[model samples]
Target: MKKKKYNTLWLSFLGVTAIPVLAIFIITMVVARNEFYEMRAIYGPNFIPATRESILMILIFVAGLILVANSLWMIWMKGMVIKPLRDIEAAAKRIAKGDLEFTIVTQRTDEIGELCRDFEEMRRQLKASQDARIYTEQQQKMFISNICHDLKTPITSIQGYVEGIMDGVATTPEMHSKYLKTIHNKANEMNLLINELTMYNKLDMDHVPYDFKEVNLKKYIDDCAEDLEDELATRGVNFGYRYNCADDVTVKVDPVQFSKVIHNLIGNSVKYMDKEDKRIDLRVKDYGNSVMLEIEDNGMGISEKDLPRICDRFYRGDSSRGKTKGSGIGLSIVKKIVGDHGGQISATSKVGLGTTMHVILKKSAGGKNG
Candidate 1:
């Protein structure tokens, strides 16, 4: 039952209005009492006049009524302002008590309304941050689960083979050679996985520098084509390379990493050639300030869905060729190298058609000079 605080100006108005009525009532009573006394004196009648006590009594009655009426009016005016503030206070308390479900009912166009909007926005941001944290934690758990499964199989195979050799179970020379080969192969797989993990960690660091230089686009293309031509011919695949760029169409990039990129794309194409007429096409074009290179193949192309994630580290799609090569980090490394050179790379594929990778690199101001 807290008392309501009335506006000071409204209370003052009530006081001012009461003053005039009180003064008039007092003055009228005094004047009427005097006139009655004067009439009695002048007429010489025995009738008694109203005295001072009667005037006082009339004045008191009139002043009390005026005060009461003014008080009720002031109470009504104060209620208009108090109710909205009380509702806002209650809502705030509920929010403090962990009930953010309450909706504010403020139509005020003042500081209070602005404060309410800010509070709502802050709550929304906090909720989003909480959701993101939960999602990240779930992803971390899944990554660990997948890593365990991936590591356990290879280590178990290596252990089994090594133990058989140690127990003298491999009697013949061929059997011993076979066991040793199994052990060696498993060890190599483990080493490769560890290397991939290590390299990713290093790349995540802030200061790992890459070697960048101006590379002759045509010469590099020719070198890769020459090296892979014999291998492709042996596998009955026709590999065509065209370097339409100028002989000096140079771009600033890491040569070693770029070589790895070419090696991986060509190697993967040859590995997954399922058709009788397998073909791979490589081409480079000079577009003044930039150079674009494309590698396209008619092998077992990836699905439309997997094209988005093919460049992600360790993301092996269902369309993967037989388990014949590296730890599926080739495309990811290619993407990272391209990105380091301030370039862009993308892939397009159809289920039955083929896959094409396009890379664009900006030529640096440091032109190629021998």
Candidate 2:
């Protein structure tokens, strides 16, 4: 190939041209010693003889040719190396300027070539990570804007209704009662926001001690579901379960927090169901000594792109905003509880199909799997 030939030529030029020129200079000096001495003896009386000048001119011309050839060879060698380096540098500059699409294609399989490959790979990874981070930040900002607008609308209405009542504009008992209930509802919404914020702050603290105990997980999940069944039924949501674990299947965790995890997941499933017979199913099974709980829902399922980040604090799928209800902290709290209990939680969903959340709780206390 042309590339192989070019590489071979550069290496040959470096070794043959540059190195031999150096050797010639040494050889010429030794060979011309007697000639120089003879010239010196013949010309010293005249000090600047014509014959000595001609001999010196010839030696100077030969030395100049050697110097020029060596210089050319070094320049050629540098071109092979420096060209790729400059290309890498330019690509890096483009990346710094916010272009993530650049790639380096160097032919030589040398250290510089390896360096270029690594540089390109690193740029690709950094761009992917940065793009994801920017998207997340934008989503967070939008959510905050939406939350602010949502909260402000109800609060403003409540304030106006209360003012009207105080100003004696509420003429009937029914009107007064409706206004009071509206105020109470808005106040409850504000309280819910405050509680969510408080819980989020607690979770953000890097290390919060969790008091974990060995829990009869099967019994616990059944109890939690039973407690929430009436609430779900009132909202036209049906709940079912398939418990395949032994009667004594257990896991080490804080019972209250573990209950909260199950509670939040089930609540969201019931709240967001889109089908006529809105349903959520919880299945528990034993994997060796560990326990696995899966919650499936026939709801407006999350998109694949958004599923990965659902557990992030304050993150809610944009599509779910109008259809679902919560402070966006429920899943985040569940993730923290599972993490503290030294377990793993993951979710899979299709846009129109449904969602399945898998929580794996280990039996041993000292080791955790992610």
Q: Best-fitting candidate, measured by lDDT? A: 2
- Can you write out model 2's per-residue Cα lDDT over 1-370, one digit (the tens) per residue? 5654356555765676556656765676676766667777977845543454565666677767876886786787678776777788798788889888766776668888799889978988998998989987987787687678667867898889989999988899999998899999988987777676677778778555677877776677788778777777788877787888777656787887687788788877876677997888889877765778899998889987889989987777878776555557788888988888888899999877789999998865442221
* Global lDDT of each candidate: 0.73, 0.78
Q: Stretches of candidate 1 above 4 Å error?
A: 1-136, 230-238, 264-279, 312-330, 366-370
lDDT of 1 at 8: 81
Model 1, residue 325: C-alpha shift (Å): 9.7
Q: How much is 140 displaced in model 2, in angstroms?
A: 3.2
lDDT of 1 by residue, 318-337 (tens): 66623544455667777777
lDDT of 2 at 367: 27
Q: Which candidate leads in TM-score?
A: 2
- Residue 122 accuracy (lDDT) in model 1: 60
